[model samples]
Target: MTIKEKINKFISEKKITHAEIGRGLNTSQQNVSRILGESGKVSLDFVVWLACEYPEIDLEKLIRDSDHVSIVRESPATYQKPRLKEKALEEIGAVLDKYM
Candidate 1:
């Protein structure tokens, strides 16, 4: 099914209102309506936020339906301090190398 269709189905099945989703996303109800409406565009950041907020929703399925590759490296809940530090170091090193 198409992304819009899937989202509509999810809305119906979950009995969730646009306002509820808006509240979760810290957006307006109108924005949520627009997001789920025809010609609505989904951003990777929005999808990631949704996936993080609602873990019951299958992110892989959402990504597939949206015709996008799943780029989520790992769930935020599973990110360890060491991993974060390592990533920070890598990013810092990359930036330094770019200048040097």
Candidate 2:
């Protein structure tokens, strides 16, 4: 599944609301709705943030996208420090392993 589809499915299965996601992302519910809707662009930072926020979700798989079709939009130089991003991802994986 695509990253958006995986996220939408997770949200649906978990009963998470757009309002809750908006609150977490410090964005508007409408914006969250748009982000999850068709034609909405899902940013790379958003994916990392979502994975960190919801560690139970299999982010590695979502990101890897075995079929290689989903293209996560990147915020220009968002993660200036690649190591920092790596660390966060490692932590997310550790958390997922521990919990799931």
TM-score of candidate 2 against the unseen true structure: 0.65
lDDT of 1 by residue, 1-100 (tens): 6656666676777777989888878999999888888888765445555545544455445445345433233444443544544443443355446554
lDDT at 69, model 1: 31
Q: Which ranges in model 2 have alpha carbons more than 4 Å from their true place? A: 67-86, 89-100
What C-alpha lDDT do the candidate models reach, one value each?
0.59, 0.68
* Model 1 bad stretches (over 4 Å): 65-100
Q: After superposition, how far is residue 43 of candidate 1 from its true place, in Å?
A: 1.8
